[model samples]
Target: MISPRVNTRVWQRSISLLSPQAAKTESNVVTKERTYIENLSKDIATSRFRLVDENGKIASITVQPDIPICIKKDCLVSIHNLNHLSLSYKWLNFWSNLIKFRSFKSSLFHRIIGSSVLEILAAPNFQTSRRPFDSSRSLSVLNLTGTKDWNVFGKDSIIAFEQNSSLEIKSPIFPSARSLVSNSSKSQLPRKFQILNGRGNVLVCGGGLVYSIELIDESDKILVNSRNILAINGQ
Candidate 1:
């Protein structure tokens, strides 16, 4: 018996977000017009399970801390709107979007939009930040408010916004994305810092703010209370 690498995966990710619900066109299984919706609002905590449909690119979803866990297998999972509904099933591998049981409340940017933002899918890694990661830094993580509401992300993942929300990444290139991943809690204060994985090609504003993102593989993720962030160096 062997084990997989810490953050490594064994399959190609079919996609980032969950797939659309399609009705079973065959007679071998139950058939129904699948409706989409967000079943819960709190946090999600569960175990790791695999799905056959999604090619294993970044599969393997784990819900350790249960704040807004979904119903057991074969149950109705209710969400606020159909659009918020992303992942659903008795088992899932990668949590492309917000679909966990554990949730940490954040009022800092709440009510500013249609809904409160949750978890944050951290952008590429940046050098240790140069600006003070506090209330001022909070504005950095607020991606554009287009058709994509920021509250959905807020509910699923925690932005590096809280103070002390730092972690030791596997490479120096990662921590460099600090400014891009900044939050009131965790941030790389050194404006002199550099951007690691520059597929994003991001730059810090005079006030330490950014208005764009390139998007890349920001996979190996974590969410500790910003206050728990200690020092981040070569891990």
Candidate 2:
């Protein structure tokens, strides 16, 4: 299969954060109502998927059978041709307004939200958009068939990824800040880097252009910030 090409606009000098008014207008936040899965897939060619573009154009990619992708449950537009898809709770936040998991690894202490499935009339496109950042970069899907691992990304960086995968948190977050905070403070918060393991595909929006750096082995670790990451597989 051919690799998909995504169109990118030149980077802006400064980006504006979402305004309260704009946040209020989004249907994703205002409504908990979901579209029928069968209905979403039924007319997927021209209907169902909604991009962040003002023109309402939709982009789509196909997922091979049993290949589970990770996505913010809210960003999911539609999925088709597969059954037996499962959901595992990733994490929850009482501190921030943004809750980051539609599918996340289980943690014992987080608050659990009740679940429901979003589907449409037909096959659905796994659609997503940039949030709390560059909201215009509508959708970007990376096929993991040829690659082994990906970079660690911000919590919001992923829209959807392969379900078979797992994520691990890395340590010693930043060099300069290591001395700034006490070791006890470090234990209180979440770890710095998250490693994604397992197989199948991962779909991500890196906010601007998405780049993949191929690593040949375990010792080849890339020292980078977590926010800049998209996804990674293997140790």
Candidate 3:
């Protein structure tokens, strides 16, 4: 059996906005908000986390971490199941090294790099919103209008982000005004792109090179060989 990672407490002092608020779940959530949700095929090997839909048909979900659930119905695959190196989020970088010691406590395998290996950060960005995201399951909320998505916020996922993986702050440019498109299509991924807000853009963070994002807007260009890109906030 694969040896599981150890339990590490995630620090939340950086984001005080989430203190008075809580993560949401499946219920009557997503009222007047543009919500996103991607179905799952199997449970991913996440250490421990929750899911919350800001724009959902439901208000809140109830499942917690460490409690495995058996599939009772036919499963469907997602973009995350395809194992495409093209759609990868590079989180390891120079700046991350600065805070590596700060995150040592919340991680499992901190310094191992391999094709089959996945590294979990000791500190995942916190997603804070007006109503507060409901992290009942594996859903995460990144409030863009708020300080959440504007800067680094929300826990980074080991898997690709979807509606089931994370939430993004609606930009003043579109979406919230119903004028933009949701970047969940697989064809949008570049030869090298990082997972961010379930969308694909030419990631330039961590001092990487700029490259084409492929099959979409030219600005969607992502940087090559960089995974520190947690999400793409711009178009």
What is the TM-score of each predicted model, taking all chains together? 0.15, 0.35, 0.21
Flag regions of model 3 displaced more than 4 Å.
1-30, 35-89, 100-139, 143-235
**What is the Cα-based TM-score of model 2?**
0.35
Candidate 1 global TM-score: 0.15
What tens digits encode model 1's per-residue C-alpha lDDT throughout 1-235? 3356543352342222212122133221111101110111122221222221221111112222221222212111122332232343322112311123222121111110112222322221112233222312211212111112121122212322211112110112122333326345454433222112201111111222222221224543444343322122222
lDDT of each: 0.22, 0.35, 0.24
Measured over all alpha carbons after superposition, the RMSD of each candidate to the real structure, in angstroms, is 20.3, 15.4, 20.1
The prediction achieving the highest TM-score against the true structure is: 2
Ranking according to TM-score, highest score first: 2, 3, 1
Q: After superposition, which runs of candidate 2 have C-alpha atoms over 4 Å from their true positions? A: 1-70, 79-134, 143-148, 165-191, 211-235
lDDT of 1 at 151: 18
* Tens digit per residue, CA lDDT, model 3, 100-215: 33442211212212233222211121222222223222223332222123222222222222222333312121112212334662223211222234321111111122111222
lDDT winner between 1 and 3, please give it. 3
lDDT of 2 by residue, 1-235 (tens): 3234522221221222232212334234112223333333354311122234332222344433333333454454444533455545443231221333333321112111112232321111223333323344334433333224444445554444434333322222241221113335432122333344433333445444444444433333334455454555443
Candidate 1 wrong stretches, greater than 4 Å: 1-135, 140-168, 173-207, 213-235
